[model samples]
Target chain A: MEKKYVIGIDLGGTKISGALATVEGDIISQYTVPTKASEGELPVLGRIIETIEKVLEEGKAVVEEVKSIGIGSPGPLDTKTGVIITTPNLPFKNFKLVQPIVEKFGIPTYLDNDANAAAIGEYVFGAGKGTENMVFITVSTGIGGGAIINGKAFRGSTSNALEVGHMTLEQDGPICGCGNHGCAEALASGTAIGKRAKEAVTQGLKTSLANYENPGSYEVFQEAAKGDDVAKEILDKALTYLGICVGNVITSFDPEMVIIGGGVSQGGAVVFDKVKEVVKERCFETLAENCKIVPAGLGTDAGVKGAVALAILESK
Target chain B: MEKKYVIGIDLGGTKISGALATVEGDIISQYTVPTKASEGELPVLGRIIETIEKVLEEGKAVVEEVKSIGIGSPGPLDTKTGVIITTPNLPFKNFKLVQPIVEKFGIPTYLDNDANAAAIGEYVFGAGKGTENMVFITVSTGIGGGAIINGKAFRGSTSNALEVGHMTLEQDGPICGCGNHGCAEALASGTAIGKRAKEAVTQGLKTSLANYENPGSYEVFQEAAKGDDVAKEILDKALTYLGICVGNVITSFDPEMVIIGGGVSQGGAVVFDKVKEVVKERCFETLAENCKIVPAGLGTDAGVKGAVALAILESK
Candidate 1:
């Protein structure tokens, strides 16, 4: 029989989502379960195994029908070595993910950073298709990024390339989680957006955002859209930082396009339009003229589909 | 005769150098002429043509064997259009370099940024030979950079990808000529080094550098080597900035190696040792361990050799 199926696992902070998909990239079935962080590695592994089993059962496929498994997890993980070195969100440190998954499933396994996997998903099936070079940026609680060059993930010399979020935009702007000052993440991340809103409220600034019991970034954006002066100021500051970061990426990489994703990007045109304007104004004319900035197309399914792509590619 | 040769021209603000080289990269003959750029573009173009003719004459029989010509000059140039759009050092504005060379020599000509040509030269025949990914940084009057990825010059989405020197290391440390704040060039270029030395002298910091009638970076390095506290302090500051820039590049690109050139890099082990120390300190352990830093081996001949490489590759 022809080889037709692959397994894709997206290991998030709280759950593991696994899917079995056909070679054509159509998902056959999927399973999801709690990651149980406090239960440690063995329990997490058990959950992953259960998810894989459930997906296979739902697909009604024998073990021989599956090709390989791919896992997309938060990093500093070693893609070459298949080790999850130390991810703050995950319970295990230096977890040997590949060997365990391969042994348990009796098939090959591959691992990659979630952001990189998402970038590959974009490159192969989403917004970056047909482009030789692209940058994918996800602006959530913390910002993350990935690069695609020449149709493959550009994994820098050490699998740590495309850290666009860590690049400094304002040298003296704010303290970052990475212990740096004025990093792009420190200025424009979801955390930063909320922090700005909170500071404005505490500083006696008048705004509709103050009505939220605890104003998060989304609420601030909501308030700003509704014509709250303080919320508008905070949103503007976030956009300015976001724009500079976008300009910096455009200048440094010169990618054909940049795909913006993550929760904060859900602000939609409010963030996207302003970022496009700032990047156009600040980046070199040549770069600004050529680069197209677009929202990520895959949305919530990007991670799982990226993992599936990895499985198919790695297995072959 | 076996496929003839190519003319490689390197245009600088003060001089124009051209070489007649075999397809195998063996130089048959070379010549240089004063640009006298103060007199402006027409005269400079005249000097460039004269140098090309002089080299062809010296090569004699090899002239008949020449295939194409390539010119490497300072940018911002339109590589696709073969036009020098604007170069701070050159008098020309929007000079069409290719039309003139092709018109006069009756050979297809290629034009690229000097830094990019140097990078291609290094990639093909110099320090970066056999490597698919590398970054070449030249620290002269100002810092300039180029990138080679997958055995070709990585010219971003447009023809202007690697402007490493302009990347910010200190968000607000110093103002750069490019109208940016805290660019790597502003912190560690030869001009920056010279500025620090002059400032120290004006501030009445005691140092052996004070004895020099006209202090340059070379004298400053000499004084620092001799254990002048102020000189050492300034040199360390420069090294710190250079190291951060290097670390950032390493983190961002993941190239197998980074080659340093230009006059300031010629300060030898003093700058090299400091740069290595800082890169190790700032970069992730895996990246720091995997990447190598080395001095550029091509010396002043890099540009001409790189232009030859460009011609050979483009002709093919």
Candidate 2:
């Protein structure tokens, strides 16, 4: 069999990362560019195209050698038509993402929400490898996630399922960015943690967290790890809410494993241990018994790897 | 195509319903018998076999004419091994259900937790017909559910993913049968409604619901519709929980439609309207915009129909 290559791209609000990989998923070359998305779609698209061209150039591979291009973009996208419906971070709506790339390279292009790509990436090469069903959740600026079932990305009716982060954890609780009350993202995400810490300071309940102006989730975790009571209280509460979200996902999806990734999970044992404890206590015993809760193995590479997986699988 | 017939059985604590259906899902004959579960597994199994025999006899079909046998029993069962792990409402543990039925008739047999069967049933022939993905939720004695994705029952990694009823809705809320705190079942199930109403009456609340000796969810709904404030409050709260569950399911699964089943949904528009309202308000606009919230189409026959769906699909 002749060796085949594919181009994988991860499109984010701040940066675009592109890579050339073998059909077996080995990255031969990669390139990155700042998105500067506020400059508008054309410039961002130019950067994305430049990154892809640079990866190919660095790999010394011709376009003819590449099987296809796959992109994982911040989305609520239409993978079927390869149209980006809307992205919170990028200024694109109903953007014909695939057609433009396909036209440029005369190759098939596939598109999926970044979260879904991460899930497929993990399922194909990371923590959930060899599993028939799994959920990949990323707790970053805001919680986001995707599901892989029966060894494929489980896109629902509109090619978008696995919006795990938006699941309502508490009724009539805090309002979320998506306008829902008490969604998992609103209660347990990095943004939520930072907001809670800020609120504590605003309420005049001073602690070590107050030292960092406009403290983010990382600062809060740092203070908590040092045994700061106020910071510890906030972290514990946020982790507890995250635990409830994990429990709910387990009960609903019953995946073989759940892979936790993102900036928040970088807290390591502090996050996974607390969340796993809640899941063990809350999920159905049978499900809990079979579920392996683990951290994502691919890390930053999840985006490009996932895009590659999507390209390979969908192309087949 | 040659005409093919299959047998489907819905085994419950109180009754066992069996039906003979063509491969195309036309039910030709059906039978039912008392489970008398307290009489033990052997007696319950005997009743189940009797119902299957009666259905076959009524249809004038020979064992050779039946393609397979499918049973949907109260679950937490191993679909791969055809074993009933343990049912909260039934006295069956590690029972080799499929092997026994297969031996009795020398026909292939498939067994699924009842909720999964109902999901397939709805997907194949009822409310979710023609959809690629759907969720079937039975809000009955206790809330339970299943999913049909890409035209197949979505048995999670352990063949038990769609435990929608056990999802955590509120932190530190009521305990569920599954021993979880603030689960959807604990907050919205018929049993929960009755328990809440009984508690209200016990608390010396003045309401017409007090006229009933043991008011179940039905009596509470009736009184609430007739202007009982206490009953109205209880009903509204329960519906809110149900709506939240529905909303959460929508976001995570992104199914084309959600088919609401169970005894509680028998209240019809009164229940559906309120729940749909909540789902519309809670789900991400992209998801909620396309989701169709409707009542279960098969009504009481969901079990047998779902079992038939399981039989036909699995046999293929």
TM-scores computed on chain B for all candidates: 0.93, 0.94
Q: Please give, for residues A1-316, the per-residue lDDT of candidate 2 as tens digits.
A: 2438988999987888899999878899989888898897777778878988899899988888888788999888898998888877788878877887788988788899888888888888898889988899999888888888888888888876778778988898899998889988988899999999999988889698888889889999999999889989988988999988888888889888999999999999999899989988998777888989899989657888888887777676
Task: DockQ each candidate and list the results.
Answer: 0.44, 0.85
Interface residue Cα RMSD of candidate 1 after superposition: 2.4
Off by over 4 Å in 1: A1-7, A20-24, A36-70, A93-96, A99-110, A170-175, A195-216, A219-238, A311-316, B1-7, B20-26, B35-70, B91-110, B169-175, B193-238, B311-316
- Global local distance difference test of model 2: 0.87
Clash pairs (backbone) in predicted model 1: A156-B254, A157-B254, A254-B157, B4-B65, B5-B65, B5-B66
lDDT of 1 by residue, A1-316 (tens): 4568888999989778999999767899998897887788788888888888999999988678888888999998889889888888877898887888788778788899998888877887789888988999999998888898766678776678877677656535688887766678888999999998888888878777778777889988888898898888888988878887777777778899999989988999999999998776556677888999998889677888889877876675
Query: Please, what are the lDDT tens digits per residue for candidate 1 over residues B273-292?
Result: 88888777655677778888
* CAPRI category for model 2: high
lDDT of each: 0.83, 0.87
